[model samples]
Target: MHLLGRKSKKMAPLFLALVVSLMTFALAVPAIQLNAQKLGEGSTTIQSPAGKGAVNFVLDNNNPDNLIGVTVSFNETLPAGSIIYVKLYNGGTLVTSASKQLTADLSAGSGIEIDFTSAVPISDFDRVAVVVKGPTIQP
Candidate 1:
């Protein structure tokens, strides 16, 4: 009778451990499925231009008819009389271009915002590229 009682006590812990492991596996299964669904989306990468400046901007879908618009911001400390040129391109074609000249003394982290819209339908293009050229920054 004493040997039988010891064997029964050992079996109790073994049963409890098995039940706990199964519960943990059940809870983790749904979280794994949710993360797998998010992996299908795509992302965009922006390349900084030449010179010693930084361009930080956001692309927003403004018009319902045209699905693309870009807002550009630049930070640079340029001399009082410096000229900067900005260009936008869709594939190999030039879409829009702009230039600016600084009047007063500018700071190193100073920036400006510009918006560009497409004349033709945005859906016609597969990829879009924006290029900047000037004395201060490039992105």
Candidate 2:
């Protein structure tokens, strides 16, 4: 019984060391940050003449990030050949616009990202707008 007690004492240190190593590994793991950008244009849900979806706008911080893109999440599938228009506006005037036509049917609740063909500076616009020219549906 004493021999068994000594063996358990020895095993306690190994167990403690294993626990410490696992804790250290857990602490060393880096955090996951999604779309870690410098600035964001906020998000909103909009009902379009063609369809409905939630839009998230992201602004370029020029942290080598000169590209602007729009993320849209619909409650239903968006059919192929549907066109999504993303526009930048300065006051009442339109600064620039980018668009993409859906190549395949986008699944419901799945978000789609449409990026500008070329770099468009965020400094040129204060307002962002999205217009969908496709099917009429509710979000």
Candidate 3:
């Protein structure tokens, strides 16, 4: 009878431990699935029209190295003889600037690509803002 009591105590603790472990796992699986769902898979694209305005691009550690490329797609036709100016700023300081003249009316879905390479390392930047200015379009 003493041996039976000892065995019951040992088994009781083991069963309690197993129950706790299963409860923990059961509670954790839903959280893991929710996090996975939040990290939705895909790329995001933005389209804008031609106008004199500014667009800000936020850069983080995840940005590509050596080259930062931005493609602006126009939603409508721009005015004639207009020009687009692209400027890159890091932490309130101007880093690089470029411009392209509008030869033909910017077609819907057609846009410009602005590339920045000469700026300081992304590690040195806390934030990056791209300002696009033109006749009618503002990014």
Candidate 4:
């Protein structure tokens, strides 16, 4: 099946676009941390920053409103050409996904924030995952 169930055709393009963007980030980079929550709030970091895997997280927005663009921050410096894929899921259905390519090497102890351009704003308790992978080995 496609990214989501066979429903609205209009949304299919948006979903595909997110996946297609993620596909370009298929570069080799080191394992890093991901923080999709706002500052001063509870931790939202993705665990197991060593191997290529998906980390599940919950949006910690207490406000009674759908989360608009989300900024995901990385804890470590990925290589100059690393790919990152962020997916947000509402229950079992995939809400939206985004990908980013690092133009410069991320320094250690540094963080990179990303904005999600989803058709629907993310909500609290929504499940989120981040998969970091690459085309080759890190330098």
- For each candidate in turn, the TM-score is 0.37, 0.51, 0.40, 0.45
In model 3, what is the error at residue 88, expressed in angstroms? 1.2
For residues 33-71, could you state the per-residue lDDT of candidate 3 as single tens digits? Answer: 443445445766644444333343423346444335456
- CA lDDT of each candidate? 0.54, 0.75, 0.57, 0.59
Candidate whose lDDT is highest: 2
**lDDT at position 106, candidate 1:** 59
Q: Name the lDDT of candidate 1.
A: 0.54
Q: Would you give me the overall lDDT of model 2?
A: 0.75
Model 4 whole-model lDDT (C-alpha atoms)? 0.59
lDDT of 4 by residue, 29-133 (tens): 456999785545465665434343323333336642454444445555566667777777778887777777878776655555655563344443377787766
Q: Residue by residue across 1-139, what tens digits does model 2's lDDT show?
A: 3755877998998999999999999999999978867544678665443456787765566654454777877777878877888888899998788888888887888888887766666576788787777754454
Question: Over the stretch 20-84, how does candidate 1's per-residue lDDT look in tens digits?
Answer: 99998988786544434553347766344333555444344464545333333345455555555
lDDT of 3 at 126: 52
Q: Candidate 2 at residue 26, lDDT?
A: 100
Question: Which ten residues in a row are the worst by lDDT in model 3?
Answer: 51-60
- Scored by lDDT, model 3 comes in at 0.57
